[model samples]
Target chain A: MVPVLLISFIPLVRGIYIGFTDYELGGQISFSGLENYRIMLQDRFFWRSMGVGFLWTTVVTALQISLGLILALLLNQGLRWTSLYSVLMLVPWAMPPIVRGLMWRQIYSPDTGALNLILTQMGLIDAPINWLTSFEWAIPAIIVAGVWGEIPKAALFFLAGLKTIPGSLYEAAELDGASAFRQFRHITLPMMKPIMAAVVSLSFMWNFNAFGLIWILTQGGPGGLTRLPMLAAYEEAFRYGYVGYAAAIGNVMVIIISLFLFFYLRVQLKERTS
Target chain B: MQRLISWILYYKGFIIAGLLAVLIISVYIAGEMAIRLESDEIQTGPLRFLSLAWQEEAVAVVQEITQDWNQAHPEQQVELIQGTWNAVHDYLITGFETGDIPDIFHYESAVIVDFALRGYLADLAPYISDEMRDDILDVNWASVTRPTGAVMGIPFLAESSIILYNLDLINEAGVIAPTNEDPWTWDDLHIAAKKLTKDRDGDGVIDQWGTAMGLRNSANILMNQSIAFGGSFFYYDEQGDIEVRVSKPEKELIGNLARMLFVDKTMSPSGVGKSGAEMIPGFLAGNYAMVVGIGSWARQQVVENAAEGFNWAVMPPLKAVTQNMGVNTQTLSIPRSCKRTAIAMEFIQFLLSSENTTRLAASDWMLPTRQSSLEDPRLQADSTGWKVVTANAQFLSTGPWVGLPGYIEWKSRVANPIFQEFFSQRISLDEAAERIESESNSVLARYQVRGLKW
Candidate 1:
């Protein structure tokens, strides 16, 4: 506990302090209260990236939960191939983020990509599209990759929640002539609410803060279309050597995430109490 | 699990004795390691060299040089550390802050200015050998030195632009070849490119492009080459502070490039999405009649990877209003905290000697900064257009990006995106020039009046 606190808190406190100072790489740090934040407010690149980040987080988290719930339902059906399917679901989660990025890059290649070959054969389009580089398709393409890599985490949580649901309740409902859909609606969803709440909150937080996967895929290019706020902060701190400004960006992100989680949890608690 | 526990209990006495034996052996080994580590600390550790050479040929050259130095100086042997060009700047910055940096490291000239000005690099002037200093070009020396005359690093290899063209295509198109003595102007290349472009199958799409350049991350190349059009990106404003500017001359190269992509339809539009090295395969495959890249890439990629019976030649450096090309030299710097500074300098001097610098630069396919190496017969050979590439050294000059505090930020964030936007025809050339100028000035405004001007 002592070691963990030392490793974690020191950096956290120092970073917060840096947010209020004029800090650069290997340069003198001076107090410049709220100056970095002032610059960030006026910076169009910062605002654009924040917009992109909000869109990415909302789309990716919502899709992950929906797809994960479906997969979990299918796996719980006691099908013959359930074991094999369960193992297969783990593959995306097992591979590291950097490896996933490289794999997707090759798959998105214009001339030799598997995706282009598949699409061409299916007569989807006349010519191959540069998915990652295209202004219109880049966001969607990365969102798909993001969804694919994370579905398994959400699926595992849902699967565990399904097991906790009492089998006796479903058995009692079936006797009352409850259909499969009705039973799921009446018994499964309500019982799964607690787990859903946990997963949704965590997933939202994780998605907003996610950096490695998107960074590997795009590096926020083709005109800053996919530059997430995290990438923006990284550019400020490391690429441009604006440490104080970068730390302020980071502080803003933490506050945003915390505020969101706070309101969401409060609503969930109120509903549970009511 | 319970059965396994019972099974283990049955062999408890023997297991206990075995565990004791293992513990004793571990302690002995630990003691030995501690002694060795203490001895190493007293000896001040091996001089660590973090080399950023990743290509097979480049890595081989670095290893050979390190091996020779290590063998010659057994007492103060050098240790080779591997680093990548991608993460090197951030890695070195943090490493220096934590005092965990290698004794010697390799980096480029433009980016090192930030590090040098921040006082991370040692003043290598005291340790530099007179022969080595005089042999290296003064411009190369200026790259690693501060505005206050503090020498921070030794510059060894320099990269400039080179055009490699398909010989067969040039002849078939009836285009005259350019020579070192008389280079083609921007207009001449534009016309030649139009003639070289072909639609072999009579389809609406062009099957062959006149030339392709990996312009995606080539902001430095674009800015450097823009000098030929009398473009100086940074200047002192009315306040006597460095500021960004994109006048008509600065826009000339980009304007012509946009015309090639959109109006003339000679240069490959796809080239703007890829890197310079990525265009080599297309050049070799006959998709492009010519390709533009660093001089070293000519040797490292085309000369090495070209198919049998496929003939290729290097064209003279392109000229617009002038023949100058911006110098982006690679350097070796010692951290101020290095324990074995003198020994590190010895290795650096040995690695940067006339013959060795030539060997290193030849491996990477760039120009050696040393005059003696440039005069050597090896670089003057006609094979692979070495003469044409070498002749380009005469036009080398200091780029305005040098010693500018916010140059890298402006290039990557402001300039590169505008270049991409215009090249892709999404934004007009005028829009690109405006955005680059305004946004880059805002980026540069964060620096001090005299910051990194060296």
Candidate 2:
């Protein structure tokens, strides 16, 4: 337990200290205090990255959770090959994130992409769309790729929750003349509350720190439209050598994530008490 | 059931032992990866060297020369290892801290000053013989020399900045073509940019731009523009002090050129932060009239990607600066701690020889550093922009940036911010200069040591 806590806090402590100091790869280091934070606040890229991160998390979580719940309910029905379907649904989750990102990037490529080829062949569009290059379509294209990658894990959690429900409860509801929708509302959601809470919290954290997908896809470009916060941190630290500024950004991320977790826990506690 | 559970618990020891055995094997395998050591048996024999060049052709040329050298010497053999561009700096810095740097490695000309200041690089004045030094071009040697008056490495190549123009666009614009003797000035370049800017179908959108300067590495663009205006950006004064002549020039030359981003509107404001993606594809599609890039790009992109019917013209240096500035990205250096310094030095000489260096340049489309290599019949045989490239490489001036340890940080803290502030009209030139000077001095103060000159 001691080792676990120490390992957990090491990154936090390191990031905080590094944020307040000027760290160079081969040069000298000096304490800069809130100077790094001040510079970060003034940086337009940092703020732009924050906005992109929020949009990315929001869209990915919403789509993932909704699709997951729908898929879980469909699979929970006494459908044929339900076990095979559940196993097949996990393919995306099993595949590496970087590989998934690469495959999607190819599909969305401006020149000679499979998506455009299919669309043009079907006569859905006369000309191939420059999906990755165009400003209007790039983010949406990335979001589609992200949602595809996320739905599998969320579905697994919901499916686990679906299994824990007793068949007798549904039979009792049927005898009481409750409709299928009412049974789900009254029994299914209440029973799945704890699992849903856990899944949602995990999903929020996972999506917040999502780096590989964005890095592999757009590299935060077409003028930094798809730049996530982590990419901004990477550019500042490695490319620009603004270690202090990057640390400040990291600190800001921590504060934001902690606040999100606090609110999530508050809701969980209130629900438990009620 | 109780009996079966008891048996399972009794066999737990075997299970635990098996798991620990697997864990030990995995750890052993992982540990062995860090132990990838070449035989130390030959440490007293053959010399080992590493070349961190990304170009495959350059690597091949270096290998060919090493084989020939090893054949003649009979006892001395050399080893060359390749590293990625990103890894080169990190590996060197890490190596210096841990004392693991190779016998010789390619150091970018820009970062050579800092490495030398840190005492990570060996001074070539002792290793490089005078006759051997005389063979290298003077300006090329000057570019690699430290501010403290010591040569760090042999000049491998000269990569100068030149304007790559779309031939079809120039012909259609009805603008008088730039002759070899009378090259276009910054003013001429700007006028051409305006003529090239057009909304072909009158859609209130520019389908073609006159020019697009590299936004990511805009400092190079500013340096070239400053040279056009007869100003030096950063250089070592006679006293070995820093002189930022271009940043606060008499004409605000660098800032004036930066204003072209917004004032002239030749480059699109929409692609400011994201430059690499914008510049490469934009030029390839006939969307830009001209681009200011190095000789390597002229050979690789303009020549290779020239669409059928798309021919390119090579324009000479603009007049704001009389001296043409050439930027060399990577320079080779030998680490001081290496035991194979002698063999490494010999290999370095062999690598820089006219025949080998020419083959290296021809394969990679890189400009040859040697004066003798520039006149090679093979390079001159090409009717493409190779002739103009060689001419540009010959009379080029290559110092000004690359001399200070704080230059990289300054580009972000001082140069980029000044350009962004100027382009936005958020601050006056006076304020920008004062801020840049104060900040850069503080930055240099931290890096400056008694032995290290800033």
Candidate 3:
């Protein structure tokens, strides 16, 4: 407990304090309260990246949850080699984030990538499309990779939820002459609601703070189209030497994420109590 | 078999994780062992030199140089610590904050300037030997010298901007090959590119391009080579006034390059959002007759990776207003936190001696900063366009905006996006020029203010 408090709170408190000061390189910081915040308020890039962070989080989270639900339903059906299939599903999650980024970077390579190769071979494109570099396609391509990496964990959550739905409920519905689709609609969807909320909340925060996959994939390039808030803060602190400004950006992100989770969790609790 | 399989399956997760942990630990241990037998001990070396040279040839040469020093002076032994290009800045920042940056480190002059400005780098003006100072071109020395007259680092390796082209393609197009003495102007390049661009197999689509370049990361290229077109971009007057402009002279290279990309259709479209290094594969495949990149690419990429009989040659640095290419030398610096400044400087001087510097530069196919090293027979050869590569040395000048605080931010945040938009043809040329000027000025204004304080 002491170690945890020291590790977590020291940086946390230091970051919060730095956000109020005008800290930078050379260790010559003077406190200019709210000056960093004022700059952030007017900074167009910060707003643009914040908007992108939300768009990325919402899209990635929604898609992963839905895809996860589908995968969970399939796995819960107890198909042949069910255990093997479940283990095979861990491959995406098991790989390091950097490995995923590199793998996808190779897959998205314009000249020699597998994606472009398959697309050209399938006659989908007349020439190789620059997936990672093109302004039009870069964000969607990255989103696809993000969803692919996180879907396995989301599926595990839903799979656990699916297991607790009770075989008796399905049996009763079947005895009542309910169709497969009808039974799933009445039982699985309702039963999965709480787990869905938990998954959504967790995935939203995780995807919002994402840096590694996107940083490696794009470095927030093709004109800052893929620059998430983390990428922005990273540039501010490290690239631009604006440590205080970076901490301010981080503080803003945390506040935003917390506020979102606060209200979201409240709604979940309200429904559960009612 | 069944019992063994069951047992294995029961502990598979732990087994896999243990295997991964072992692999990582072993790789770390192997890297440590590869460096030295005593490297694992805390007293292995009193000094640590972080180097970013990753190429096997370059790494071997660097390791050999450091090992030689170690054998000679066991007391002041320097352990070579490996660093990567992508994360070096962040590592150095954290290291400096904790008062533990490398005793001696390798980085480009462009980047080391930031540290120097922040007072994180040691002043080397007092320690740099006169022979060493005179032997290196004054222009190379100018790159690492800040406005305060303090030399930040010793400039060592450099690569001038040059054009690499297929000789057969140039000959086939009936374009006279450009020599080091009489290089092509921007106009000459545009016209020749139009002539060389062809639709082989003639299916309405052009299969081959006259030239290709990855335009996405052209900020550094622009900063360096735009001087030839008389675009200093940032002009400093002796009166201590600064002017940042993006006018006709500044726009010439990008304008001609754009026309080649779109109007003439002589440049490859795939290079629109990529970098010159990324487009090298297409150049080697003979899909593009010419590739404009650093001189080192001709040596490293074309020499090492190209197919047999690729028939490639490099054009000397092109001339417009003049053939003055911007120089940003790869530098070795002593961090301010280091206790062994004198010893580190000596190690640096020894490491960058004429013989050692030449060998090191040759391994990486980069130019040595020292004039004596440039005269080395191995580097001064005519074969594989070495003559053409080294001939550009006379054109090297300290690039515009040298040692300017906030220059990195402007290049990355403002200039990169505007250039990417223009190259992708999403923005008009006038819009690009205007945005580059206005946005960069705002960024520089903040820097000017912060520079006074920090």
Which candidate has the highest lDDT of all? 3
Model 1 lDDT, residue B26, Cα: 82
**Candidate 3 falls in which docking quality class?**
acceptable
Q: DockQ, per-model, please?
A: 0.29, 0.19, 0.32
Among these predictions, the greatest DockQ belongs to 3
Q: How close is candidate 1 to the true structure, as a TM-score?
A: 0.90
lDDT of prediction 1: 0.84
Error of 2 at B231 (Å): 4.8
Q: What C-alpha lDDT, on a 0 to 100 scale, does residue B94 get in candidate 2? A: 64
**Candidate with maximal TM-score:** 3
Least accurate 10 contiguous residues by lDDT in model 1 chain B: B445-454
What's the C-alpha lDDT at position B410 in model 1? 79
Off by over 4 Å in 3: A174-181, A263-274, B1-45, B237-239, B452-454
- Give the alpha-carbon lDDT of every model: 0.84, 0.70, 0.86
For the record, the alpha-carbon RMSD of candidate 1 to the native fold, in angstroms, is 7.3
What are the clashing pairs of model 3?
Answer: none
Residues B273-333, model 2: lDDT tens digits: 3334345566778878777653444456555656777777667656554636645544678
Better of 2 and 3 by TM-score: 3
